[model samples]
Target: MSVTAAPGFVAAGVAAGIKASGNPDLSLVATADGKPVAAAGVFTRNKMTAAPVITTRAHLEATAGHAVAVVLNSGNANAATGQQGIDDAEAMCAAVATELGVDASQVLVCSTGLIGIPMPIDVIKAGIPSVVAARSADGGQAAATAIMTTDTVAKQVVIDGGGFVVGGMAKGAAMLSPNMATMLAVLTTDAAATPEQLKAALVYGVADSFNALDVDGCTSTNDTVLLLASGLAGSVDEAALNDAVARACASLAAQMCADAEGATKVVRMTVTGAASDEEALLGARYVSRSNLVKCSWYGCDPYWGRIASDLGSCGIDFDPSKFSVSYGGITVCRGAIDADHDAAAVASHMAGRNLEIVADLGLGTGTATILTNDLSHAYIDENMGTS
Candidate 1:
């Protein structure tokens, strides 16, 4: 149990023939025990959002962030299908609501995969009954598996905060960038929290985790991060609750980066001593999103020039000569120039599957961290043949 690790939650995953690969592609997570939960979500800000994302946003708004269930599907992103797509999304929500004896507005929907294809509504609808029947506390793993696209492994995390617990499942592996990344994550908690608290916690947690990951610099139309609080553990320590949620979200984010499509290196970039944290984050994101830098990392090249040039382009005023760069803690460049370190040693250190890059702006005490992956040919092959 992951998302279902919390009290008052149950989940199910079933195959509906949505994916051409015949993988499990439909899932349901509900605040079971016949109760509604306090829920809040952050969706992709993409102008061309998916139908399910639009429908879910409306549902959350109409119900004041109160939701009973989440209907998630993979392999067919119900996007760009016009009115039919909207209707299909709404129908999916309504069907789940009817089966669970909850209002349609209490349901949220999400879909991922190839865009602009009509949803197989009938096939999916026919499977809803069985999926509903399969819902159980132990079904979290199934639910996690069903919501995966290019992900090689299911991402889940559980954090116990003394009297309360925060648990979640996430999927992403590609089409990832800042601004929430191409991901779908649902976090559940058993703590007593109001709608406002849930919303605030989700916002805080997502910004520090999901928003910090960049795989290919392409955001998904169906990206969503939703949180549901059952309040089954009674009131919780607010600080502790927030910490648990943040830790869980961060854990899932790390897993997604590590499992990123065709990525051999999980790169953690940290920027320190900027004028402000925002500037530090901007600088880090600029470097992480640079294909040139990612390509360099993939080959274990100590191309400090690629990293230095991007940081210079970040528009942050800093003495180029004063900044320094490192690869896996091996300082290769200092004072904006080569540190006279052994070039072979630095490149060898970068050969590992795990890599860390640090850039100190030497401006102020501001700092930021970003999680990203090295670009590889496998990523190109997987994404190119997805249709």
Candidate 2:
């Protein structure tokens, strides 16, 4: 839940006067080793993305998907601002490069908060120097807090006992569904990895993690998950690199589920015995995002039918007679039919902060796990406050 300072990287967060509320809105995370050896990004599916997303995409492409620093801001999405917005986002990157003595293409930019607002470029420009100067190892937490909108707490994860070190932070609360979510996450590791290897590892990690969660079934135009490897830990060892990236990503993904907005419970929907991993993920994600299923969990209702029905409708080829379900270690349904398990005990188990729903397809060995949050009135109230 916390990231200690690692060698070669320094981060800083500053009140850039971008937000009307006067909170820190700009942050910088950079490495002293110059450019990162490898990087991978998963972006929002929303077609109407912000200027920063557009500009960053271009930079990543131009650099063949590598970066040395990331500059982020909150309170103004910098979306829908057209040409000027693009100009401003690039300017932010250029400014950071000037301060850090790196190429502009080596800096990635991200923004979040109210949509349709133009960035406060003047304030951001003024704050750049200070943020650059303030960068240090422990600045990851501050950078995480700086990019939050309605989030009640900063999301961070770290694992250091292994031979390599991996750490990361994420921000999300509302508008969180996948094809990406209304979220921004950054992960760093000292492990050495080639760009291709890093990209592969990230794709594998997110397949069963960030891509699994949904808060309100709404995707943000700015959702992005970026991973950077400084290679400061030394030459690449394929196995070690994979382990570090997987551990870091898994930890951060769990944090995102646990901190889902107004969520009293975090659920893991595991789908097994499918014909393929893709089919299992398809079915599991369907159950995770079903409003009725989420509400059942929130209300402490043992509605196994809702869960089973949602999974069945996901367009995966499966026999109804082969299905089975369990809630919190209690088998509530078997062979495509309801079980005689005690509903009251299952409901009580669902009331806790963590819940697990296992679905067996009885088809094949392929499987996948989806993470999600329980739906609640408070989630509605929190997001609607700004609307």
Candidate 3:
């Protein structure tokens, strides 16, 4: 159970002939009764936005953050395709709306896969009826699998929040960075919440989850995270709901990092003692997005100098003498200088699949952690094709 773990939601996925490999490439998530529900979305910060992203944003605005359903297709991002792309996205929404007997304004749309290619609108529209008819409580995993692009495995998370459940699914393997990563996710909950409350919770959840991931330091054009609430479980504590949403998002984000394209190691970079939490995040991101540092991680090398150099050049206010670095609980650099520690022990820690790096500025009481992956030759090979 993923999205369907939350009561009042039904999901489905089907092969739409959109992918050349004939894999399932279209998915749908809707209220069990085919009625509109509260929805809020966070989209990519990229200027070159995809057509579905643009249409979905407008529909959410028009409906005042309420949506009856969401239709998504993979294998063609429907981006950079001009007016026809926009029309195709709207057509998908309309098709779903007609099947549910709802206004088109109440439907949302999403697309992910190769960029700048025209979507197979006819093929997708033909598949919509079957996908809609296939919607069932147990179809969440199928929906999750259908949205995967380069992901080696489907990502899903479910949090049991006592009476209410929070469920979510996400997909992304590369071009992952801040302001939302290269992914599409749908989060659902039966808990009662206003549209504003849903948006606030979603924003807080995304802050340290998807937005904190920096796999390849490349943001995609079609990134979107949507939270839909059915209000089936009435009147839960707002604080508890927020916590559940945050936990769900965190779990999915970690899954995405673990399954990053050709990734062998998951790096957790924590930065502490900064002027502010924002500065700490900036400092941590500087290290996470550093190609040299990622390569060093891949090689299982404890190169503290790379970390130091990135932090120094990140333009954050920190004293050089107060900077320190550690790996796997072992202090490798203290006071911006080499610490007398066992090199063999440090090397041993770096060889593990899960690596931890801690940098303390010794400045103030502010900290942040960024999740990233080590650079690998396989990642390079995975991206060499223009398919």
Candidate 4:
């Protein structure tokens, strides 16, 4: 169990024939009692938004961040289809709401898969009852499995917050970047909380977790992270709730990076000594999303020049002559030039499945870290075809 592990939540996934392979494509999550819970969502900043995203945002607003259920489908993104797409998303929500005896505004929707494709509304509607009937505590794994697009494995996390537990599941592999990507996540907690408190915790959690990962630098139209809390497990302080949610999101982020499409190495880029933490993040993001840098990582090359160039291009004030770069704790570049060290040791370290690169700007006390993966020929192969 993932989401259901938090208690007060029931989840299920079913094969609604939305996928050509007849795999599980529909997933539903709701309170165990079919009542609304405190809800907060973070969506993609992409301007070319998907229909499901629009509907879900509106529902959250209409209900003032209270929701009874969430319905999601894979294999068709229901994006870029204009008004028809919006209607289809609403219809999906309506069907789920009808079955649960809840208002449409209390049911949120999300879709992922190939973009620009219309949703199979009738097939999904017909399967709503079955999914609703199948809801149980044991269905969290199935729900996690159903949301995957190109992910090879389900991502789930459960964290103990002293008095309460926070559980979550997420799906994403490619198209991962800062500000989110082609990902959908649901977080549940039994700890008592208001919608405003949930929003604050989610914002704090997402900032350093999901929003810190950069895979292929492509943000999706359907990226969503929704947190729901049922006041069943007694009360928890805001700080504890925020920490627990952040821990869960961070775990999920690491899992996504490990399962990234065609990735061979998971890399952590730490930027330090920036003029500001924001500038440090800018520098880290530039290096993480640089194709040159990613390709060098794939080849097990400690190409310090690429990192230097990326940091310089971040538009942040950094003294190139004073900055330094290190790979796997070994200084590779010092004072913006190559440093003589044991080349064999550095090469051996880069060959591992996990690695870290550090860039010290020698500016001020500001730091940030970015999690990413190496670019490979297989990544191109996977994206060259249909998404």
Consecutive 10-residue window with the lowest summed lDDT within model 3? 173-182
Spell out the clash pairs found in candidate 3. none
Deviation of model 4 at 59, angstroms:
0.9
RMSD to truth, every model: 1.3, 2.3, 1.0, 1.0
lDDT for each residue of candidate 2 in 1-387, tens digit (9 for 90 to 100): 233344566677888888778888898778855555567787888898888889888988889878989999988888889999999999999999998788898899998888877778988999999988878777877888888777778887776725667778778877777574568888777777766777787777676566777666688888888777776677656766666666766777677777777898888889999999999988887888888988988987778888778877888867778888888889988887888998788877877788988999889998988878888988887767553
lDDT of each: 0.88, 0.80, 0.92, 0.92
Q: What's model 2's TM-score?
A: 0.92
TM-score of each model, in listed order:
0.97, 0.92, 0.98, 0.98
Clashes of 4: 0
Candidate 3 lDDT over 15-108, as tens digits, reads 9899989999999999999888899999999999999999999999999999999898889999999999999999999999899999999999
Q: lDDT per residue, candidate 1, 1-387, as tens digits?
A: 999999999999999888878899999999878578899888898888889989998998999889999999998899889999999999999898889998999999999888888999998898888888999999999999999987889999999889898989989888777484658999999999988898788888878888999888788888999999999899987788888888998999999999998999998999898999999999988899899999998988889888889988878867786799988787888888888787777777798888888998888988998999888998888877644
Please report the TM-score between candidate 1 and the true structure: 0.97
TM-score comparison, 1 vs 3, better candidate: 3
